[model samples]
Target: MGVSVARTTVATKTGEVGGTLTNGLRVTLGIPYAAPPFGAARFREPQPAAPWDGVRDGTRFGPVAPQSAELPGAPAWRPGDEDVLTLNVWAPADAPGPLPVLFFLHGGAYTFGSSAQPDHDGAALARAGLVVVSCNYRVGFEGFGHVPGFPDNRGLLDQIAALEWVREHITAFGGDPAQVTLAGQSAGAGAVVCLMSSRRAAGLFRRAIVHSVPDATFSPDLAAGLARLVAEAAGVAPTAEGLLSASPQALVEASDRVVARYAADPDSGPLHYDTVIYGPVLDGALLTADPLDALAAGAGRGVDLLACHTTEEYRLMHQVGTMPPATTEEDLARFAAHWELPADLVDRYRTLMPGAPVLDVYLALAGDGFFAAHTARLAGAHARAGGRTRLSRFDRRRTRPDGTPVRAWHAADTPFALGTLDAAGVDFLTGGPADADDHALSRRMIRAWAAFATGGDPGWEPLDGATGAPVHVWAVPADRQEGPAPAHALWHDVRAVLRL
Candidate 1:
């Protein structure tokens, strides 16, 4: 893990780029994969990168896409530029041959995340013996805003461009492009699902790892209506020309206001306010059909798949205050009704977890509806389509520095999988100071992930449709356990009733 202060350079198709070798890992940051999406290029498909002459320094991170400064516990708003189509790469400094690659996408509900987040550092994963990559794409109005005369889902197009770049240039950085695996969390996982169905993204990778894929897709009508709301907030017309005239900061603020309004009064619009406002649109050209529908039709026929969710994915929403804490029986009933859930759903949950706190009950229902159910369905579909699929449920709980308990909430497995439990913000999501047990769990997860990237088994059996081993549970004391638990069956039934 010794740091090599000397600069290292690699020749990519666009040009020679400089990087740094730190602790046995070479990291190249902020290499643009496409032309800047500014002015005329806004809301359009990503274009090829402008070739450079001399070696360009790629050691520093680039500015993220224009976005609101409203994330909880984040620092003061730092305005980013429109020219933010960049990516970062981490690979072993002295690998004898090109290693397998893992291309990751960051999740911010499709609106508010950047690859530059400290927790997303790929060095640890690279040290574990793979070429790890992360990229930044447009978000919010600049990425998903549906104005007239503009192509839809431009963010996804940016991702496709980055993947294509990897295909062309990763070998120079000691990565085997043919053995690539695409992995993501939350909205990023949703993007992976979308890409699995995208004709544009076919054969970009050989394997997929999707975590906590939320139910967030907007119909064209819903996207258009949301665009009008964003336009009105920015004091502009809903047309591309009118939106293009506004400042990037204005657009960010306008998108933030629209999100806030949706949070405050979720029922005010045709869209379901409970879901993310900005996400991949079911535009026929980019995304031919719903991801599930596409998967059912064997869209990702040859790809290996690993899909999973935490035991309590909804706690993150409650922790962030987007959803209220459920307390009374009346509160449970209200939540059920709000989501148009069947009346008997609450009683079913009560039966499933007798004497459980109302908050826990509510979390169970919401978690299944939002994450677990869809992920399970996606796994089943992939398995049915003759693809190798593995499923898991993370159940590790920890105490924060302040002694507050953090359950297996959304994203709790991220630090473990990345082998970055000591990183900042991990303590908040996964409690304080990871113990020996935590480190052991992290090693197991990292090993499994890296093994999967290497086209090897992850020390667990693939999900079996006939024998009913639907999920592998990851927890303390016991690293892995096969199960077709009653709770999972109950959740499947609940999701069926709610059509989630």
Candidate 2:
């Protein structure tokens, strides 16, 4: 789609911004939500964007946050800049008044991702009669690295800043600030859950859609140990000044080395035999407690929530060769012991899968431990807290070019929900051309998401009790399903035991 030079301008509290009209939608890209977190500002809370003196051009995307060049099945890094605290907007050109806003946060494991990625285009969603916005925040060492004398979770603070910007400026672009729906996938979903528990972001958004939220949180001691390892890799002290002296890429490389070492020997680290080291930290100030505990205490009391996970979320990790294709019973038992899970859990999983392959059993156990378990717990907590909550499972399956079957994996619902199945740069996730059934499923997802953003039911009942209707399943032929309650029950106890 070629963008026509139909100049459109909107006035924000800071100043005016000029955008372009394309395909019946007005898009304003790279609007700064906060000042560049570089130099002395690194590792600190996000500061307000400096006001511009003239109408700023919003025609192209801003540089993404500096991150590692390595990613699974993605192109090489494009050398992003430190001044990357920016956002983009897509609003219907013909909407006369304030429309519901769908604010999105991209995901890359709190490590590598950018809003400028082609897969996150918001034009289709905008054309569906809603205003869509996407923002970029720090990731990896630059965002989550632990250092003395610096605040933790600065990346999350950057997101909070973007939400504040939306509350103060989205109205000028035909979006209702009060009707904002915060949505994300993977690491982004984790951020949304974190924000839901933050007092600073209490009324910033009225609704939330969390897709494939992984169970990862860094305890203070574990985070401190990881910080030391990163600093050792960089040949510097674990302080803000010591880290600032090194180049951003060097810091990223050092962080990667630390992660690899930890993954190789989970028993040697202060992480209690856990491999993954980066994510939201449990800082007492910004994040008082675990998100589940916060939700149970009514932190997200009034926010309508839609939390979902793919039926096979961990398949992507296995398919990309990052993880082994299969695991032994001994390895599974070790993992269960690491998480303090019961010894009989592996037997129970085998019973659940009856004659399944070792890989299938491993995927089931890993998926539940990492993604499904947390998602189910979050949904149940929200619903029990008197908050309107909906749970879903994405069962859409596809085949790879090599004839390998790829089930609905992590991030499979993004393009479908955004109505961008045909968009560029998503072939790896969606595989071959989408069939008729895929298109139909995409339409249903878009419609349901839009309906939920408008504060209406998404053609399903909210989660009542464990015995109520199963989660609204999204598949080639969409339908309501059951039988996940038992798995959820199992995980509920597991998470409680692990205090996750």
Instruction: State TM-scores per candidate.
Output: 0.93, 0.93
Alpha-carbon runs more than 4 Å astray in model 2: 1-5, 70-80, 265-275, 399-403, 483-485, 496-500
Measured on C-alpha atoms, candidate 1 has an lDDT of 0.82
* Residue pairs whose backbone atoms clash in candidate 1: none
lDDT of each: 0.82, 0.81
- lDDT score of residue 240 within candidate 2: 68
Name the best candidate (by lDDT): 1
Q: lDDT at 236 for candidate 2?
A: 89
Candidate 2 residue pairs in clash (backbone atoms < 3 Å): none
Tell me, what's the RMSD of every candidate? 2.7, 2.6
